[model samples]
Target: MAMAQNFRSAFHGFNREDVVRYLEYLNSKHNSAINQLKSENQTLTDELKALRAQTVSNPAAEAECARLQEENQKLLQQCGDLAGQIAKLQAQMEEAQKNKPLAEEELEAYRRAEQAERAAKERARQIYCQATGALAEATTQVDEAAEDFKLLSQRIATQMTDLQSTIDRSKEALTGAAATLYGVCSADTDSQ
Candidate 1:
């Protein structure tokens, strides 16, 4: 830009025509510089407004972000709770596995005891059957023996009666023989 010429005397320094021309030139340059600066300022102000609009948040977006953060925290807490529950269940399963052998042993012992009891009962039943059979056989034998004794007693009684009858007949025959001999002897003596 150019500066305007100033004079203190009428004839001591620059000419009037030269001063007037220099002042006009300076005024034009100044006006052109000011217009260019104003245009640049306006462009810069527009860019700044656009930048502020991009950076600023709407109310709905801000609320949505807050809600999403709260939900994320709740999900994280639930995950931790599920992990704890899984760990507890795993420990219980391990404890049950440890006791499995003992439980099986006890079950086996009970089965053996039940089988032994059943076997003993069967043996006792067999013995009882055998004893009943023996008793029946003994009773049959005793009955047969008693029948034989009765038959023998009857046969002995019949034989004794027959023997007594034969002895009485023999005695009567001997008495008749003795009477005949005595009559003969008495006749001979009388004749002599």
Candidate 2:
């Protein structure tokens, strides 16, 4: 461009009428450069607007929201089911605990009854043994009494035989005394 200015100066010294022609060529070149820059800026602006509109119209964002809502519903239902199961199990455990003491009491009652029955049976056995011992002692005393009676009967028969012999000897002595008295009486009568 400096060389073009020098050429314009030299041509101007030749004829002052060429000054308009040089100014016209420089203006045309500047105009062409400005038009190219304006067209490029307009094309970049249109691309940015198209990208903004496409982002607003997308279906992927809507599908992701629906999926999240469905997952939340499933989680809530699962939690409710678990809570119900826990409540039923707790009730069953409490019922079993309530019956435990009653069963233990019944078992203790049966044990006490058996112990009382055993004590009663032992008392009966002791009484029976005592009665049997008393009966045996009485039977032995009766047998001893029978043996003493037989010994007393034999001693009485021996005393009766000795008394009969003494009576016979006394009768002979009395007959002799009576004969002597009769002789004395006959002699006295003849003398008189």
lDDT of each: 0.65, 0.56
Q: Pick the candidate with the highest TM-score.
A: 1
Residue 49, candidate 2: alpha-carbon lDDT: 48
Worst 10 residues of 1 by lDDT: 1-10
Per residue, candidate 2 scores C-alpha lDDT tens digits across 69-188 of 455455445545544554554555455457556656766887798898998899888888887887788777777777777776666656666655566555555556556666677788
Name the lDDT of candidate 2: 0.56
Candidate 2 stretches greater than 4 Å from native = 1-78, 142-192
Q: Model 1 scores what on Cα lDDT? A: 0.65
For model 1, residues 71-184, the per-residue Cα lDDT tens digits are 555655555565565556456556555766676677689889999999999999999999999999999999999999999989998988887787777777777777777777
